[model samples]
Target: MSLKSIAAKLFAGVIYKKTQKWATNPVETQQRVFEGLIRKAATTSFGNDHNFGSIKNHSDFVSRVPIRDYEALKPYVDQVIKGDENILWPGKPLYFAKTSGTTSGAKYIPLTKESMPYHIEAARDAILHYIHETGNADFADGKMIFLQGSPELEEKNGIKLGRLSGIVAHFVPAYLQRNRLPSLKTNCIEDWETKVDAIVEETIDQDMTVISGIPSWVQMYFEKLKARSGKTVGNLFPNFNLFIYGGVNYEPYRAMFEKLIGRKVDSIELFPASEGFFAYQDSQKDKGMLLLLNSGIFYEFVKADEFFSENPKRYTIGEVELGVNYALIISTNAGLWAYNIGDTVQFTSLKPYRVIVSGRIKHFISAFGEHVIGKEVEQALRDAMEDSDAVVTEFTVAPQINPSADLPYHEWLIEFEQEPNDLAAFSNAIDASMRKQNVYYDDLITGKVLRKLVVTPVPKGGFERYMKAVGKLGGQNKLPRLSNDRTIADQL
Candidate 1:
């Protein structure tokens, strides 16, 4: 690490210690930090004084602002990308983070210099704490690994410059590149699929220092591991370091991952988005961590309440009692006031602000009264595969709609890396896991309402239908995981 980079890390650590202490004092103490950002944003050129909502100074604002989905913010992002000088804060717009939504086309979210610090700082703090908690002087002692993200930046002219991924690739120390995701042979120029394949091949022989990426993509590579080695973690990549991943719940992937590697996958739950760097893992073994970006936004928590409450406004982080489930809403340093990305979570601790992801509001199923959530369903799938040493290469779950029957149910279509005997046992284990891991599904099973779940295997690359449908047939592209409808189920 450069003296400058080391100093950057230390500064972030100092900020974290202060924030961690503040988290312990009660949510009220955070009012100053959270309110400070809102006020700072207001005074900036982006605030549009005539349009500042529900807030004058930080104190003048409501405890929480109404949460809005990305569709609601499309106009603002569109304006900024179109060079609406007045829409942006008083700074050179760094670049826009590209994001996609189910209903909306690509969203280009403008990120300003002021908000960029929060993203950079959160990333720096997470690494420092991971090193501290794991006592892994690896970065300090030697090489480190990072599952590199996209390698290029999108430009309006034929080519502009590095996008976020290309920038990260550039920032990495030269020494680390020799070691970065050792399996990936290509340099930055390789496209996503080629890079992913090289990464998969490399893991077989090398000692992975650190690993990162979305859980779904990570699992896809695990199949390659199975094909080349025909061995578990002990047989290949035994000297592997910790795995830092997010973008989706890791709980569902636990069983297959553990079985394939036969090792503990130390995780750093990351809440990174193209829009912003939201949160990171504070401890090596912890499931969740303190969100240090409070300086970047006003945080809101929407508790699970009666559907369509007479008072439409939901709970705030201030009013949240510990152990309550809430979806996060944020007003960013970029001048996005009150945005909700549809993620649901539960507070595990008040101090240090620990949380466990519940599921997405749009990503669940209530048919058959299963109320099966994306995270829970994922967990059940993993647990079911625990005892069976099946080599599953790809899989997708969808809610089964039985028009003639009274209720819907869950179904999984999987493509295996290696076939397994005892199909009955495998299917049974999956059933038991679903009923045991998910209470909602268990209730339905007990009531004899939902159909007995079933697992069917497809040929290799069978799940590619959705990928082709979306024109992202290879590489970083994947089918929408854990869908609520039969569009996915019927495809099988």
Candidate 2:
């Protein structure tokens, strides 16, 4: 066997067994991870202040360290930025992962030595698990291209600042680097469009077998590849077998991606954020991703419906119920304690602790008390385009709370690559689908409390232009799908 195949098999043998044990005893694994993180960081300022030494279990830890978001964590992060050691994690962080800042201004997330491995290892385990189940290991012999951010980092104080993917790119092992595409020089190109062109030029003739990236950017690369090669992705790279994606759901982009590739490829969905590497899709038949219980991160869940309450109930992995949407809270080895990552998820399987990312806590439309979410909007769009020729390149929805003349409504700005033959019918189809999916929306429409959802067809490349203008055109930069106010709507 080749070196690549041997490494993959050896890696899979270990992680697959760990995953099975994790599935069988997730509670034990989580408890051990949480206690270990607490004990390891007990000497840090935040940990000392929170009395980590006195904390015995999850309940004690929860009581000691109150939940916080970015704003509350900024002071400690600021100290780290100023070259303070042991401010959060032990010693100083190597780099700070800058968020896309689509909803707000850019925020810097710290990455420590203890935590960086989780990001890299989670990705490896995702692919390893796929191989374990499917017996498809031949792809390891060929190259894999990861569409990530620039590897060149900027130093702030003593810490570096760059995208998470860019930060991780620096640590690609020597063995894997040989089979990875896009030379190190090309990866340092700051501009996303320019970098993609360079990547296409570099990898056009390589023996590539695996592709990993956010769906939208990968789609852009595929389009450019097709344009140059005059063939589908499958024809261009016949050995391609795996497509690993995250950051956004692949449902809306499924049809377009299938068309670009010209064949169905095995896919694995991962739930990774600036806060932590959380979960990944393990089974093709299973819809939800298996939560990583031993990834040096402690998981907590606050019921989504009660998240805004004065005292929201928090549940651990041992307490979470299947089918309920819960806002995710995480405490990590990187010194984040009960940090709300602003993402919501629903448990689909309790046995293995599988979850589906429901939506963002802040990215929801409830202006008129009708709660609509990213999932609903995506599903509504999927249903709307099922019978039509419409293909969405990008979209965002916002509330028109007080229009000059018309009643209050949700305005949808959709950029379509292929327009539907009947535009009015497409609009009606979207309106009908929303009503069918959401009873509250249906009730509001029936009572004439809100006008029909307004559909505005944006010119091709409108959203991409907007992202580029905002300096967020590349890795992990996702457009917010829903907003409670007219901020997004007016901007569009």
Candidate 3:
């Protein structure tokens, strides 16, 4: 083994032990994080406005601060944008993670110096944990590619602004810098298609052992590699064993990935966002990611079923229950107070505070009162795929409220790498899985309020073309798994 691989294995042990200290005492660790966040930001303008000074406990804090999405928090964010110090956090933010917003044009999520390290640390520890568990740190000695956004940043009001992935590129640990691939110039290319081509050209023959990115984008790179080299990914990069992904569930893409790579490889799922690094898959054997309670963020959860009701009760880490979907709200050292990042999660393991991202709070189908969520749809499709030979590249679900010949139903727009032999049977299988999981959908189908879901086949590359047309071709952008309306469905 190389010296770096030896050091990585040794370091992984140390990090794993440190993580256990907090992971074992989830409630106490979260309490410390909560108190620290409130105490540190108590003098900021937001704190003063919200009576943060007199907040003695979680109850007091809850009564004083209401959960605010980006739109509600914009006034304070505007002040920060105009170079106002002490408006949100104590002073200026280190950088703004620019992200696409629906109602708002672009959201600038603040990344402060205090909170930035945790993001880097969470990602690093995820890998180290894998190394420690499997005793396979040899990937550290080979080239690794993190397919991501441009490292280039634009200066705004003395603060740098760019995609979160782009901003993080500047902070790659010096030790791994030499192993990271896709030259900076190639990464800076504006177009994703062109960038992937460039990346393929650059790393087609390199000793690639680890690859990381959103699965869809990584699939694109893999497809291009297969076309150019005429070899499966595993054959091309024999050392490649670890695949790291986030932003979307990988189960839907697993079959396609296995076919492309020609083998099964170990993978890690990360729950990261511009707001904060919330969790990472701590064990390959476990079902969910371990929530980072000691990170510089205080978490709150509101039951998803009651989230839209007036004054939904928010539960802290100590109060959440397993298997209940909850809208994740957070307050952080980055100065977001009681901010709803619009994600829903369910606790899979309360003993260690592990969670799975269930869905987006707004991204669901409930046109006919059948509130089908992302997790359900993804799970239903995955179950169907497991029972068949369908190789789906991408898919999305939207309610079809009106039809020319039949009762309204759910429309599944799917792009397939390889189609199933019997499309009707496959669709029935998906519908059956969905009905089993969601009682509302089952009732709707039985009562003839809504018909069984219809699978509308999208031509290969159709979704990619749609994304390019919408000017959100790549780099951390994820297609919503399901939507209430036919906006995406009609376009597809």
Candidate 4:
């Protein structure tokens, strides 16, 4: 056997054994992971102050540390930014994963020597587990293109700061680096258009097997490739089989990808955020991702409806009920204590503890009591596009709470690459889809309290212009699919 094939087989075997153990008894696995995290962080100042050493079980830990979001943990993160040792983690973090901040211009999430493995190894095993399940070993034999942020990391207070994908690039296995593209020089180019141009030039003739990145940016790459080569993706890269994606719901983009490639390829979805690697799609037949219970992170869930309440009841892994929407709470080796990452999820399976990402807490609309979320809106749009033979390049939804006209409505700003022949029919299809998905919206329409959703076809490049103005044009920065207010709508 080839060296790569041999390595793939052995790696997959080991990961399968580990996953089998956790699948058999996730409760036991989670308890062990929780205790290990506590023991590891107990010596740190944040942990010591919270009395982590005295915490013997889940209840004790929960009673001591209150749930917090980015704003609440900013003080400690500030200390870490100033090179304070043992502030959150055991020591000064090696780097900080900079993300779009709500209050500030950016959020610097700590990445330590201890916590880095969770990001790197989990990503590796995500691919390994897929190979094990499908008996696909030939993927490693060809090149893999990872569309990511600038590989050039910025320095602050003697620590590195950059996108998480760029930081993870430094840890790519030496052997695998040989099969990865584009060159470090090309990746470091900050401008998205320039970077995509460079990538197309560098990889046009390569024998590619895997492509990984956020869906939007990757779509840009695929489009550029098609424009340059005058061929479908399946024809250009005959060996290409795996497309690994995350950072946004892929449902809206799925149809576009299938149309672009001319044939469907294998896909794996992951839940890797700036905070940590949480879960990955382990089985193609399974609808939800298998929660990474043993990845040096302790999981907690708070009912999404109660997340903003004064005292939201927190549930451990064993306590979470299937099919209920919950905002995730996490404590990790990175020393983030009981932090809420803002994304909401619903447990689909309790036996192996799998979950479907429902939406973001801030990316929901209840302006008129419809309580519509990102997932529903994306699905509705996808169904509408499918029925009308239209394709959306980018889109966002915002509630127009006060209209100069008689009724308020939800407005969708869509940039379509292929516009539908019958625009009104397409709009009506979307309205019907939304009514089917949301009972509250249907009721409001029936009662004449709210008008049907308004679809505005923005000229090409409109969404891109908006993202560029916000300085988040590419690399893990996606347009929030839904908004509760008109801030985004006004800007668009």
The TM-score leader among the candidates is 3
Report residue 100 deviation for candidate 1 (angstroms): 2.1
Q: Model 4: per-residue lDDT, tens digit, 172-230?
A: 98989889999999989989889989999998899999999988888888999999999
lDDT of each: 0.62, 0.87, 0.94, 0.88
Best-fitting candidate, scored by lDDT: 3
- For residues 83-185, write the lDDT of model 2, one tens digit per residue: 8899888998878998755344678899888899999888888888888888788898888899988888899987888988888898887778888988899
Of the two candidates 1 and 3, the one with more favorable TM-score, higher being better, is 3
Positional deviation of 219 in candidate 3, in angstroms?
Answer: 0.2
My TM-score estimates for the predictions, one after another, are: 0.81, 0.95, 0.99, 0.96
* Candidate 1, pairs of clashing residues: 153-163, 183-202, 233-261, 252-378
For model 3, the superposed segments whose C-alpha errors exceed 4 Å read none
Across 1-492, the per-residue lDDT of candidate 3 in tens digits comes to 999999999999999999999999988898898888888888999989998889989999989999999999999999999999998899999999999987888999999999999999999999999999999999999999998999899999999999999999999999999999989999899889999999999999999999999999999999999999999999999999999999999999999999999999999999999999999999999969999998899999999999999999999988999999999999998999999999999999988999999999999999988889999999999988987889999999998887898899999999999999999999999999999999999999999999999999999999999999999888998999988999999988
Per-prediction count of colliding residue pairs? 4, 0, 0, 0
lDDT of 3 at 161: 98
Could you give candidate 1's per-residue lDDT for residues 198-262 as a string of tens digits?
A: 76665667665566666666666665677777877545766555666766677656656777778
Clashing pairs in 4: none
Clashing pairs in 2: none
Residue 76 in model 3: lDDT: 99
